[model samples]
Target: MTPSLPDILVGNFLCMAEPPPPESAGEFMAGKVGVVALLSLLAAQEAERGPSARVWENAAIRAVLTDAAEAYGDAFAEAGAGVDTDFTLGALDRANAALRRSLIALHEAVETAGDVVRDHAILRLYGQMADARRLDMPPLPGR
Candidate 1:
């Protein structure tokens, strides 16, 4: 006999545990359904896009940093220094945030000067910072 929703509810309410082994008819239909399949598909999609999205974001940041470094000369040397490190999704994320904040200053400085070369370069950096911020991972809560 197929289990009913009430039977399943009695067995595993609030994700307490697996539904009881309902030997009777009404209990059989009450167990969880294709949750595994849905979860599997979602996991696969996240795995595929996760790395490439981060890499692409890093590439965009790199392009902006490289340009700004050239334009600013030696001022941003340290900014470009550790940026090339092999960062996990987490570390790269933190750095991405800092870069975004830095882009604000870069924009202000370049905007006041109106130098075509620096102006255009800073524009690229601004766009990149915006893109990076959008792609940035969410912060983890303190344990």
Candidate 2:
């Protein structure tokens, strides 16, 4: 059976952590290994969830723009009508970039119009987006 990427990463981390060399640089090497291990774990998490998060965020942004269309105009509607057909990380990232640009424009328009309700709604979505992308990173050593 093929080992999953996360499992493989963790396995490598374990292997690398053991049998520390009996050299003066052993501690330094351990520190470096710890950092790499932490990074590997984070990458594992991203590999599992990053794509879905982007897709969800894209849909969410589109929904917000669609709702704003009545107040904003056809441009808002057109931007919101975008759908994600490609699931590749690069494609998702590119689409996210485009949608976020539109979101920025929509937010600016709303702010300029003094639409407090819409502005607050966009702000809330921004918070949600940040929360969704958050990783469970471990604290660094020695605070």
For every model shown, what is its TM-score relative to the native structure? Answer: 0.45, 0.77
Compose the digit string of candidate 2's lDDT tens values, residues 1-143: 73444566777768676776668366788786786778787777878888999999999999999999999998989999968999887788888988999999999999999999999999999999998877798887789
Q: Tell me the tens digit of each residue's lDDT in model 1 across 46-68.
A: 44554555566656555555567
Please list all clashing residue pairs in model 1, or write none if there are none.
1-25, 2-25, 3-26, 3-27, 3-28, 3-29, 4-26
Mark the 10 consecutive residues where model 1 has the least summed lDDT: 134-143
Clashes of each: 7, 0
- TM-score of candidate 1 versus the correct structure, residues matched by position: 0.45
Model 2 off-target regions past 4 Å? 1-24, 139-143
lDDT values for all models: 0.53, 0.86
